[model samples]
Target: MAVTVISLVVAFLYGGPQALFLCVILGILEVSLSFDNAVINATVLRRMSEFWQRIFLTVGILIAVFGMRLVFPLAIVWIASGLGPIAALDLALNPPPDGAAYFPNGDPSYETLITDAHPQIAAFGGMFLLMLFLHFILEDREIKWLEWLERPLAKAGKLEQLEVVVATALLLITATVIAPDDKVSTVMIAGALGMITYIAVNGLGEMFHVPEEGEEPEGGPSGLAKATGKAGFFLFLYLEVLDASFSFDGVIGAFAITSDPIIIALGLGFIGAMFVRSITIFLVRKGTLSDYVYLEHGAHWAIGALALILLYSIGTHVPEVITGLVGVALIGAALGSSIYRNRKIAAREGEDAVKTSIP
Candidate 1:
């Protein structure tokens, strides 16, 4: 409700049907690019409780709008500038010559320009996304390179941290191997930021005094409701995070078409994200993932493709539309397959019912 009202106000304030149309087009684009995110998010959201869902819808917006929309672009600018946060602040306040070029057309040419102006940060974000995709692929498979270390760690009951340490080390190594020529320091900084964010969100959640609803006395139904709520909140946060990451390309790509920041943020931020959120919720309620087997699998595959697009953007150019359309096609195929499976099941059930009656 608040988001809607705020969007309305912004729309009116930024008046002109052009803004509204941009909003509509960008909204469609954003939803299309991140549709897979919605499906995967459902996997986590299913575990959350109703109360948490509301918090997610509310607080989650803050994280998306402020954190992703505002901070992320600034972060890129800071890293690219190779300046401290203070220096970055100065640059933001007092524009440098042609800083306007950064937001060209609606795409942040920071990546292309960063290749010239701030290559390091661009490389870092690309490498980071690549590592994440690779790590995801590895986790899905069962390769035990750590069996020897795992044995000793498990004996001491401290294997989980060891696994994390190993993963972190691996990512760092990958980043180092592919360190960008122009922005090595920037890449390192970006990598640190990403790591810090993960630790703060996940680790703090564990260390904090946020009490899990205490064990119900006398075996009363546990406040599984609260737990579910927390889960839902986390799921919502996950969706926001996923949305932000997915939109980075679109936001940057929009610049390829136009140089208007107002249009970029206004068009993409409000319109694109809303439709995506609605479609995600509709699918969740409909249990599309479960009913349409392999949808999650397809979405994940799309994520992998997007990650590649980001990485490729590091070396050469790839159109945002290409990346988005690829994702849509993959997910669409999954949905189509699911429909076929559902129909087949229905037909089988009907046949069985008829056979039983005949007998």
Candidate 2:
């Protein structure tokens, strides 16, 4: 397929076997870390026509390469410069760069750039995701508060997740107001920007969302397919965003092993994404979710662990490998349990069938 060719082309541009290896490794790692995201995304994909599903994967590629692998580091650099000097030092000390692009003309050591940027990226990503997850958790799923408010406006769409994001923004603003006027403001600003991004992306999803029945019900997204569709799309969107967050550590950490940013990006971008996509397909085709009750439970636990790692990465340096291992262990345990459960259920069903035959 075109995607496969493009992935290889990108890898070739980065150059070398090491680049290929890293791309494969990081891609696999990303997919594994984000299994829950894939499952959740599938829920949305089910609603979309086959055409839309392909679009998701294609757009997803763009997000990973341009947003996470490329622009994100620069954004983090901006955040670091805006914060204090010590923050930058903390980030830079970890690793050195392999090479430099033409625009900069100088191959600033990875260690130096990271240290200069400060490690606040970890906090920015961690807290931002944490808040988004919490909003989903706390939102009034049972009641349509937005529907009531929109009665006068005659809006057909329910409030959706927009309220949760706004609430998060408000909370960040409050924190900004209460904190000391110096560095806290900078951190708060970063957090706010993160939330704003969430709003922007989710808004795009809503805008592009082509619900059946042409218009959503007064309550919005009713029925199993509709509900799962929206949730899954949001889940997919969140996963991509989450993957972007996870990549910060992976890309930065790649330098500790090698200095080439091209290699780092290629390694972490294409191969990593492919592995995850393959896993996602397997899970979907096999009906892993339906077959194993606790699979989702395990994935959420991994998500939580990754979130913690992201938060900790702010003040303390946590290796990307450690984060990957923790997630793998959790998901592995879940898969094992699922196997045992399926066997037990099969045995019970066999017994019942035997008894009926005897009669």
- Model 1 TM-score, 2 decimals: 0.68
Candidate 1, overall lDDT?
0.56
The sequence of per-residue lDDT tens digits that candidate 2 reaches over residues 1-359 is 34445666676665656556666665555655556556545534555545445655677767876677655664555453463444433434333243332125443443445544433555466555655444443344332222343243223224565545544654454345533345465556665666677667666566545454344644554534443465446646755776676566666666566544455456566556555555665666676676775565556556657656765554457776788788778777877887887899899999999999995
Worst 10 residues of 2 by lDDT: 94-103
Model 2 Cα shift for residue 98 (angstroms):
10
Model 1: per-residue Cα lDDT over 59-123, one tens digit each: 66556555655556557667656666665545444443475545444543443432343233333
Off by over 4 Å in 2: 1-32, 35-37, 75-111, 115-118, 132-185, 192-239
Stretches of candidate 1 exceeding 4 Å from the true structure:
1-18, 75-180, 188-237
Query: In angstroms, how far off is 107's CA in candidate 1?
Result: 19
lDDT of each: 0.56, 0.57
